[model samples]
Target: MQNRITEQPSNYRDLEKKTIEELTKLINTEDKSVAPAVEKVLPRINALIEVIVAKITNGGRLFYVGAGSSGRLSVLDVIELPTTYGVAPDLFQVILAGGVDRLVEAREEMEDDKNEAWEKLEANGISKKDIVVGISASGTTPFVLAALARCRKENIDTGCIVSNPDSPIAAQAVYPVEVITGPEFITGSTRMKCATAHKMIFDMISTTTMVRLGRIIDNQMVNVKLINHKITDRATKMLMRLGNINDYDTAKELLFQNGSVQNALKSLNPDNYPA
Candidate 1:
């Protein structure tokens, strides 16, 4: 509704009669711009990560609020935090515009109601002990902005990830993240570039925050929950490599005994020294 396509020519229209190779070239070109845009916001992002780490360390929670494509992506990011970094599921939550059913399906009409966002947060018992990161593309999503405003009124720390600088959402948040991913290839269809930018920003935030919370060691996800065979396999290998064990059996045994790669390494090696 912001008429974002009018401001950027590259987002005006799609190729009408282009070859597959040509279309791919254009898309790849647009994709390349996303990271650089995110790069500009790294300093702000680092600060927000530090803040989130402090809150989490103090037994607080992290909330992601958004609508439509942004909301679905935020949910995906938080859903993986537990298995990927060993964070508590209850500590990380997603508040979509119309709720869980809308995430998988469509609920475009729900994006207009500002009060619904606050209701969602209230249902979760949001407090000042929590950190909220709102995601929106045009930075004008009433749902996300209103949720952030309510959080601010309640004295909760708030941040945002948006594609436009000086957006209304950014203006309302204390720590605003402006990725400036430009316009979409489909002219205001933010599910394209904006969605990718929000995902990248969410990844950076979660990964960096977990690192600060000691969930990682030397680029290894040491706190990853072994919730499945794939994770179990990864944990076994990590334990084997870190403990200098010779066989899979020894690694698996230690992993089972200690229940974690970090603990297994401690049992096997004691310290990073030749035994």
Candidate 2:
């Protein structure tokens, strides 16, 4: 069997050396290349964001599916959405090959199974109104490809972020973003450049989608939830600055009364609302 992952590596010539400085320099240069590779796929990422924003604006949720490191990344992105954008927990979802347990620990023979991924997605009641984005580095991960294929069959909108060109996972997705990072410093260690590129792509996708959905105002994170002490303090300051209310106590009282700065501002004045 051909190892699709081991077959690609553009930096093997440099890893053969024993010098520490050589390895450090080679890794730094390779890491620097990740952003440019991601930049090449901006147009594609933007399109996916547009679709995601439209769906979310229409009361639809977004889901991320992947396996191994890719799966973990998806989980991270979903977990952060609630705290960052004040979106409901269900607004963003994630699935892994071995389930949530695989997040902290690895599972054996999990990614190899094609049927398990769709089963998990189906259990969550994925439908046409929702958006699914599969993340894979090799672009041939059975788990990721299977999830995308099932989504296609169900007439659901699907997209993929992969690190290989003409990848099966990409071809299966309606909006495929291929970031060709070439290879790893340690040969097949995709957790290096591949993971970084995947994160870059997801950051662009999620942030842009949030912006389009009006979670952001100007460059500010206007939708963040003030659910904790730190967030409450930050939200109070932001409201004070935005509403021209310099009194800290008044700002804190307003935020506590309304539970959200946007709502508080809107309730304070009908015409001066951010909406």
Candidate 3:
């Protein structure tokens, strides 16, 4: 029951009275603190990522459980992994409060329903092989907390990203990441700075995990799915560069034949591909 820093008053007051420039400047100033707060928790984030990579490597999935803005952001992150890294659609999933189908409705009240998250997770056949990470700016959301609690009872590993210290959600997590982004520009409106930090952390976790799983080669998304003209063109160019082919048409042909830059490169030099 300690004070939640995210719920504290904003550092800048009288927002309604401030000029447009003044408001933007003040908000930007507060925004500068979010990165350092995340930086302070790098070690904790790394620990969670390590576990995620190991579990996922051994036929496990990563589930992000959250509500409100956190849940929406997680959805955005999970949906991109497949096209970005050529991973399976189900490899990374989300268990959003109110359900992802109703995400556009912004059903904030559903966050208080503690039973829903566990039911959804159970329906997904959650087991010890999967890792679930909770996302809640307050670190006290009933929906996320309950799911993690059930996960613990079932011996499924859990992790969390919260903006408060010593929160109940963190206590339930085996690998807790407390970023402590502090009060928002608008008092208790965690959708601002807290959401920003969560987005950054999501980028870190997914990008790093994909890299560790050998989805990248020399900083290129070699495993990226060529599902569009733009991406196909990009992958074709990447193949030309990596395969040392001077002709774009030839590389494009190779890319289409193999279906991916990684595969095209493998066809060119099988020894270059990772084991």
Superior by lDDT: candidate 2 or candidate 3: 3
> What is the full ranking by TM-score, best candidate first?
3, 2, 1
The RMSD of every model to the true structure, in order and in angstroms, is 3.0, 2.3, 0.9
- Model 1 is weakest, by summed lDDT over 10 consecutive residues, at 1-10
lDDT of 2 by residue, 85-149 (tens): 87789887888778876577766358888998788778888889998888877788898888898
Q: For residues 112-162, what per-residue lDDT tens digits would candidate 1 score against the true structure?
A: 889987887888888889988888877888999998988888999999988
lDDT of each: 0.81, 0.81, 0.93
lDDT per residue for candidate 3 within 1-275, as digits (tens), equals 48799888988877899899999998899899999999999999999999999999999999999987977999999999999999899999999988899889988898999899999888999999999999998999999999999999999999999999999999999999999888889999989999999999999999999999999999998988888899998998999889999999999999899888998888888997873
Shift of residue 218 alpha carbon in model 3, Å:
0.8
The 10 consecutive residues of candidate 3 with the worst lDDT sum are 266-275
Better model by lDDT, 1 or 3?
3
The pairs that clash in candidate 3 are none
